[model samples]
Target: MQSCFFSTSRTTNDGSNETDQEGSNKLSKDKSIKKNLLHENIYTIPNFLTFTRLVSAPVVGYWVLQGNYTDASILFGIACVTDGLDGWIARRFNMQSIVGTIIDPMADKTLMTILTVTLAMQSLIPIPIAGIILGRDAGLILASFYYRYISLPEPKTFKRYWDFSIPSAEVRPTMISKVNTAIQMGYICLSLLAPVFDFTGHIGLDYLGYTCAATTIWSGASYVYTKDAVRILHPPSNIKK
Candidate 1:
């Protein structure tokens, strides 16, 4: 009877060990799945279109500096078309992605920055207007960096910081922000084409510039006051309960 009791205790201990091993394995699998969900597929047609704009921005800047307005205008027009098309395609086809949200504005800002700087250098865009546009964008960019850092999960290394696949925050542009971007793009487009058409000193362009400035300031303020402008996808581990 004593030997039988010892044998029964041994079996119970073995069963408990198996249960512990199963729990550990399940926990490990859950972590792996969670990590996989963090990384999204960033390659899509919309992304490709947005990428094209990023590539074209510098070329447009070079042309503007070189006084090659005709080709610059053509390429800029194409870039603008792709910009709208990509967004539409993304929505229509359910190809929306977190990376697209980041890069689309990035492409827009890159193009606008290059053109604004080059045009300002040539005295096409008023210095004050350029400053306003640049300043607003700079502030937003800095805010984006802050949001990204705070929203990122723990172990935030440099590699993870730059990894767009691991989306930390999603930016939702405000209504005024959308309007501001549209006005800014229109103003820039006209500025790019004015030289080609010999409308450099047109009073209408001046009015557009003033409108752009107003919208730019308004939109920047909207982002500041709007609580939902940037949504945190995954708060840092420290921030989590």
Candidate 2:
């Protein structure tokens, strides 16, 4: 997640609604909340662009798998451009939202994850490199949801899909994590370009693979070892000591 990894502060609604509500009440409340959030945040230009990037992920990966490097590279570049533009617009125009904060990196991650898998399947990238990226992200995502579930009151009956607040301010990115993402993106771009065009001697897509793996692992470990993420996710309640 290139976006902010840490929320500014920690908060908890310790209150609980143990009693069940009527299905109608639950559905109406869910619809009402979704209506409000979408009305307030979904219509923004930055978010719209972000959504475009999200939509582009599968298309980009499909092109890669089909061995259409030209189209894949072009679509990937467009997605990256849209990502950059959304961030700039959001910050420049003060259009930032909790939704943006969460979805921005999610879009990036989704695109990269899909691309990585597709490329790895085609042997463009090493399995270990792909593993590091996917593994770290997979674990972290589950962790994010776990923490969010712990921090909020999960509805008994399903309603809105986007009614998640777990990817909150606290779930932020680190400097190295951000750099790792950039390098991974760069590596993918270079990898795709290598097939279509000639590049200089040793553009280092190979060596960069190891670098990404190490950094991805370290970034995940750093989050827990540095006590920033673990304290928030697990806390001291379960500590035997």
Candidate 3:
């Protein structure tokens, strides 16, 4: 009878041990799944809106270059609207992502670059002002590449580097940078529609150009001096030693 009692006790303990082990494995899997979800939540509504801006950029530029000002103005208006809407949605609905930080500015820069060049080609904006805007964007683009490379995690291959899901850095636009972007956008939108309203040679447009140039310079300098403009989340594997 004692032997039977001992055997029963051993069987019960073995079953309990197996149950505990399974529970631990299940918990670990759950934690891993949650971590991945938090790491790569890129398909949010704000991101989609931002994507629309990207797609609209080249179309707006094409229309501008083809002398389709009315269509270009309409598309530019839509782009501007999406630009503001995306940021608002991101803030309002808590759908912000690291990818949003990277691509939002990217879309803005792309639009600015295309329009700046096209408008310059048409002599809508002063050549010097266009050069200033393009130059500042060029410098910022170079800095972004360097920061991204240095902040990326181990095995920084081309694919992973472009894979924004593996976010390694966050870009917090400086106050001056934000103002500069708004001013720049307004200037570009007005430039696109100037022909429609016969406002091409207005003195106000020249004043706007001067303001845009000043803000462009100030904002570029702000990025240089601002300590927390770019935050590196992961130290590069190259310097892991």
Candidate 4:
């Protein structure tokens, strides 16, 4: 009688195992469908705006190199405005993506690199200044790669005013970056207006350019340093939490 009871229990367990396998298959199929749908919707409106800014970089560079400062300044301003707008739209509409975060900053860096190098070559800004800015930018890029390889965890929150003030943990861009960008744009606009309005005599374009360059170097350094601090403060061990 005991043997017969054990045989019945074994059959019951096998039936339950088959039911679980069937449920798991259905769940996996549902997840695959959802992933495909998400992949198709990656290109949101905010991302489109970012791509537009990336595309405008070369056009602005061309205008500036041709001595068309006014057009270049106008286009530069438009691109800057779009950068802000893209972030706002993404957050407002819940359209943010990992791709957008990566692409948006890359676009800004590429635009700044092109403009800064072109300006330096044209003698609008000093080469040393461009070198410093470029070096800092390059360092940040390398640091990013390092962080990824080490599997750095993301911050719980984006608000870090104290962290922004420090040079080492400034991995995240702050309002200072926006101000630096604005000053650079102003320098470019003033350089264009100097020939037309004879403002070079009153306010030299070279001086303005130098100021912008100084700020760029300072901000870039701050960012790189702060990022390092942040990494140290919250190392890989904290990732498990």
Highest TM-score against the true fold, candidate? 1
Q: Model 3, range 46-113, lDDT digits (tens) per residue?
A: 89988889989899889888999999998888888888899898999998888899999999999999
How would you encode candidate 4's per-residue C-alpha lDDT over 1-241 as one tens digit per residue?
A: 4775442322245466555566689878767754442233546899899999999999988987898877887888899899999999999999866556556887888888788777767776668777876876788678765544343234323342122221122134656676787786677556545655666534566677678777877777676556433333332331232
lDDT of each: 0.91, 0.73, 0.88, 0.66
lDDT of 1: 0.91
Cα displacement (angstroms), candidate 4, residue 145, comes to 3.8
For all candidates, what are the clash counts? 0, 8, 0, 9
- TM-score each candidate: 0.86, 0.72, 0.85, 0.65
List runs of model 2 lying over 4 Å from the truth: 1-40, 153-157, 164-170, 198-203, 226-241
Residue 81 error for model 4, in Å? 2.8
Which digits, one per residue and each the tens of the lDDT, describe model 2 over residues 86-117?
A: 98998899887766766788899899899989
Flag clash pairs in model 2.
4-172, 4-173, 5-171, 5-172, 5-173, 6-172, 7-169, 7-170
**Model 4 TM:** 0.65
Model number with the top lDDT: 1
Model 4 ranges with Cα > 4 A deviation: 1-41, 148-171, 201-207, 227-241
lDDT order of candidates, top first = 1, 3, 2, 4
Shift of residue 47 alpha carbon in model 1, Å: 1.0
- lDDT (Cα, 0-100) at 168 in candidate 1: 83
Provide the lDDT at 33 for model 3.
58
Work out how many backbone clashes candidate 1 has. Answer: 0
> Candidate 4 at residue 49, lDDT?
93
lDDT of 1 by residue, 56-83 (tens): 9999999999999999999999999999
